[model samples]
Target: MSDLVAEHRTRSSDWRSRPVTWLVGTGFALAVLSLVGVGLLVVRADRAGQPAFAFLQWNLFLAWIPFVLATCLAAVHHRRGPRPLLWALGGAWLLFLPNAPYILTDFIHLGRRDGAPLWFDAALIGTFAATGLILGLASLLIVHHVVEARSGRVVGWVVAVGSLVLSALGVYLGRFPRFNSWDVITDPNGLIAVVLERLADPLGNPFLLRFGLLMSVLLLGCYLVAWVLGRGILGPLNGRVTR
Candidate 1:
């Protein structure tokens, strides 16, 4: 019993000394705040006698999946380098990565309902969107570092940019066709058909182009801001971890 306790304490102490601890702690704190915001929305809905914005809860839950995956991938990569397990985790992470930022498009529901005040709904949605965006960016950064460690700096950045581009398309598909990440596995043919039909007529479906471009630009700007802020704040700690 004493040996087990001592081992647990030693492991905890070791984790605290690592930079990823800070990231994980911050992510957890933000997740709690997001959950609180969702709870408040639920309370408001209860009072209003209608189910308004309940979907936010599920959306926020989906948003966390990628962050969790990225954290797991980071831990695996740290322990085992670029092994097959790491690649499998990476694939799953990328598949769900867009979900984190997909909440931003929820702003379209800003004034669509009446159970809650416009201001309150705006604040609630904004809170979830911001939380989701931060989680997404943080995960991307984690993956970026892993890629950089494996490949060169140039390739790392290329992967990062490519991820953003793909995520933008993902957001579009989710918003328009309402395809879930699982659909890729459960209904690949249907998903592919929708994608092809949408792409086959660019002029007829200008909205797809417009939406994708807007989202890509928005994601890129937000990511750049996040990267700069993260570097400014965690530069020394990050250096220590990477070393």
Candidate 2:
């Protein structure tokens, strides 16, 4: 027990020493800002007697669920030897991962409003969606780093590609069928059955296939851009940061 505790402390110390900690901190601050921005939008809408955050409140909540989960998992993954715990956290992270990027779909709600100008609504949705996307990228990078450290580069790439594909499908389920991540826990068999049924006839479900494919591409592209920009920003500190 003493040795286990000591090892955990060492791992925690090592995790805190990494450069990526700053990135995580920045992402969290941005997430808080996004939430605050939405809250202001809701207040403004209410003051104007508009619908006032009927759908966006729920969507933003869902987006934050995955961000918080992934952030927790990122911190936990840095510790060694609790393989089962890591697996459980990783599974949960993947399950809710789609919700982060799912905010992009909220753009469909953008339009003229009673009190707010069209640009205001557009900016509001854009900020939330952009923050969600950044959150997704940050979370994904943390998970990828963890996997790469434990596994190898090839396996890490596999996990990345697989996550993109699966997340795309998850987004489809959430957007069209109105399924939530908890459905997997609440209705495991039903969710599995629906997923299997859909997989069995992927061709028949054209919308699902197309949407999933398109979203996957978009996610991959956005991830690459975010990664490059992050690297560029952190490049100056690379000599001081541990690989």
Candidate 3:
């Protein structure tokens, strides 16, 4: 036990010593911003009519949050060299957990609907399929930027290949995704059991996923869009954050 504890401490110290600690701190800060941003969006969603900004944040999460987090985390971990992409893939799904309640309430329309939508099958397909594309494309850009900044050839390649593979898988499984309302967090007296039953089979597939053919086109288009927006426009404004 003592040996194990000492070994753990050694590893912890090594991690702390890494220059990537700053990046890790930045990532955690971004995660906090995501929560705050999402919370505001939820408030807006609960109002009689949702605002465009609300949908923007919501769609940003749906489209890009997972990928942003994945790229950051993967780049940090890629310090060790190319490896399997399981943790980053798993991170995408785990990231969905905290956002589930908001999704049930806002996206699933549990508050307004007496039961789940009839076209749930199509909805899930569109939701998660689009999700994978957004996330995947965002990951590609973020990882590319990080690699350019860090001068890691292998890390860049791993991120490129692994992100693509896991993204493909994310598109596949995320389609037709199922969930349980699991006791509405927003509605106290909500019909928990009925809500669960209603949302249980609600769909979450990608809208343009179409076995990734459509997704590829859309993803590539978005990549160009992001370059224009982030690197071209915003980069000049942000003190020239090169690479």
Candidate 4:
């Protein structure tokens, strides 16, 4: 009986030591929390006798796309190195990356509803926004690792900063012009035209300039915090797994 117990303990220890175990467990927890946020929206809708913030579900779904892509990209890079497939996944991931942070702009709808109290609505939006931002930051970290592994730390930081800048622009275009990620493919000319029109007269588009700068700064600050905290939290687990 003692031998069996010892063997069981060994098996459990081995399971806990695997990085994949941690990855899957963390993903599962995030998914559960995302569902809980969706549930809150549903409860709000039912109580209000209308579908309030129903779009959050769709937005959250969009936010998950880049996260899923990042997870796949990380797994592929770990197993196969920088293959063409990894680059392809990386490109797709970048396109949808803005969607994750875009949920933050949904706050513009906070007082647009009637039935739900302001506090409840604020909480509902806050839950979704927080989840989306976390998803975005988590995905960014995974891709950052891939870049750092491929090039050097300097190149990694450059790519990360550039990605955040583009993500900020993407969020602006998404909120103001209402262009989806797929527009880059479907409405390339139109998208280019709008961007050029705005760029042609930066002074005339003060709002664009202001929003871009503010959002870029906000994203950069958030990413920096996530990077430092993530390293501190995961460093021990990583050391144990590597050892």
Q: Evaluated with TM-score, which candidate comes out highest?
A: 4
lDDT of 3 by residue, 89-131 (tens): 4345333422321222234332343223435423433343344
**Model 2 agreement with the true structure over 55-127: per-residue lDDT tens digits:** 6667767666655666676566544437777788889889888888988898777764567777777777777
- In model 1, the clashing pairs are none
Q: Where's the lowest-lDDT run of ten residues in candidate 4?
A: 234-243
State the TM-score for model 4: 0.87
Compared with the true structure, model 3 gives a TM-score of 0.35
Q: Candidate 4 lDDT, tens digit per residue, 1-243?
A: 999999988966674355355457657877987988989978987888888788999999999999899989878866755468878998999999999999999999999999988999999999999889989998888788767766667777898999999999999999999999999999999999999998888789889889999999999999999888765544422111110
For candidate 1, write residues 77-150 as lDDT tens digits.
67755577878988999999999999999999899988778888889888888888888998898888777766
Backbone clash total for model 3 is: 11
Instruction: Output the lDDT of residue 12, model 3.
Output: 63
lDDT of 2: 0.74
Cα lDDT, model 4, residue 152: 62
**By TM-score, is 1 or 2 better?**
1
> Positional deviation of 218 in candidate 1, in angstroms?
0.5
Clashes of each: 0, 0, 11, 0
Alpha-carbon shift of residue 151 in model 2 (angstroms): 0.2
Candidate lDDT scores, in order, read 0.83, 0.74, 0.44, 0.85
